[model samples]
Target: MVPEPSSEAPAKSFTDIQTRNGSIYTHPGLLSLPPSSGTSSSSGKRHRFSIIVPESVTDQIILKCKAIASGTSVTHVFIAALAMALSELQPPKEESYAVRYVNHSMINLRPYCRAPYNTREHAAAPYHTVSAQALGIDLVVPGPPIDGKDDGQINELSQVATQVRDYFRTVRPTSSQDEQIAVSPLMFKSLTTPPGSDPHIVSDPPFCPAVISSLGNIGSIVSASHGPFELTNVWAASEPIGAGVAIFLGTWNGRIELSGVFDTRYHDSGYIRKFLERMLDSVSGGLDVDNCTAPIRVTPNEEK
Candidate 1:
């Protein structure tokens, strides 16, 4: 498993989260999308965009993240980059300190289930974990510089990313996790077949959601030439539900490829494009890997 998400957030915490939605404040205009009929991914109303991060940049980000903590992984790098993008797109409001964001990642249960059920691909459960200081205004703007460079942002990014890493690291295999995997099929059925005007979900929709799912290193599972076929490219996406977008990422052939999709009802293609652009922009930095310290991160190329 490259990385899987933690348990779903509690409803009590969710109530507190809505009161402080950072994503909404960061880009209020983005939510005012064009009128759309499509409501879900299955409704044929999803827009998409893809990103292929340079291998060098990917390695740099990964290394910098590891400096934050020995346990930090690629997923944490993305999470930090995501927090940066959300913050950079718009300045935070005066009350931005209350803003929050939720990360929704699915848990692949094949490793936990028995041989007969292990083969099931949909044997996964959704996990929504909220952060206390997501996209915090103080994380970036008006921050001190490190070594005459904006390494302050780097340190901040690492802090944000490491928090997520630590949260997941604390999770262990539990009976609840096993139960969620077992009932995943019923959850899937609920998605396709709504109970009524309001569909019942296994968990509440995430607040200021950043739904990220990593397919890990696809190169490990897929080969370029299999039998008589040559694989040139592979594309995949899981469309957004509710009000946020979903990002599906995988590393292939030394490059980290990412695809993000959102329902038109909640977003415009341009909005999604801009959102992803900001995200990749945060990742595609030209920083000296050598300049980075365990407590400091290299600044983005534009900043330098």
Candidate 2:
């Protein structure tokens, strides 16, 4: 039987880790730029699209990543794949001005909430009345094409995946309740501050090139029946917040869905579609994985 989820607060060691890495918000290079000065009215809003990864393919990806990177998980592989896709789609031209892709992933704090506040049962509770919280952490990775010939595709992805895994392992918060609460005020302050004043008031700039949020396994959540209710599909979407792109990953009924939110000012619908297709192709062995040595082609998907 599955054990009940823990409601304990994070430990002291965990809080220490969070405090040390809090600089993510203030990193100068990670700061975002305001929407272009000559922006058109249409450029003000965000757009969204989605792609589904069948369970079979997801399983294959998991097996492949682990075989190549030892203990790396699917999320690490996916993030590495995303970094690769972004690099392919927008290769930086200048040697000195390459883009350093940064991904901010949401970390759920539900498990650390005290007592009754620990479970999703209190999701409807008012923000001020509940102890639930969530935090975002930056995962920085190299982007832009290398100058030399490409190495074996599988080996390359594995190397990237290992780097991703090591980065997360080093920076992830240590489990501690007090530390989680201590950081809440900072997150709140950052959220309440005006965008125009964020740079001046907040020491850390809130700039992320890309964001990834996983909702974990939702099969059980939907499986809970209510008066003969039956569920079919499950997915989630969100507005593009401060980032050029955001991708939400969720699993239900054994399938994983990737919902990508993009700022139309930066990328169009066609580009988003092609980006998703390329991402799928990269993981599903469409790209030559055994011995290919050239950068993966990133052709746009043709409109019907």
Cα lDDT computed for each candidate against the true fold? 0.51, 0.52
Q: Pick the candidate with the highest TM-score.
A: 2
Cα lDDT, model 2, residue 175: 59
* Cα displacement (Å) at residue 52, model 1: 1.1
Error of 1 at 38 (Å): 17
Error of 2 at 145 (Å): 11
**Per-residue lDDT of candidate 1, residues 1-304 (tens digit):** 2122254433334444435544535642231112223434433355666666666666776666567688887776676667666655444443332223444335544555444444535444323222322233234342344466653333255667777776555332354344344344433443465447542121333233556777778888778898999986665665455556677777777767766776554555556655665656555442234321222211111100
Q: Residues 95-140, candidate 2, lDDT per residue (tens digit)?
A: 3233334544454455555656665677642232112232222333
TM-score of each: 0.60, 0.63
Give the local distance difference test score of model 2: 0.52
Off by over 4 Å in 1: 1-44, 94-96, 119-155, 172-194, 198-208, 284-304
Best candidate per lDDT, number? 2
Off by over 4 Å in 2: 1-46, 92-98, 125-155, 171-174, 177-181, 195-208, 285-304
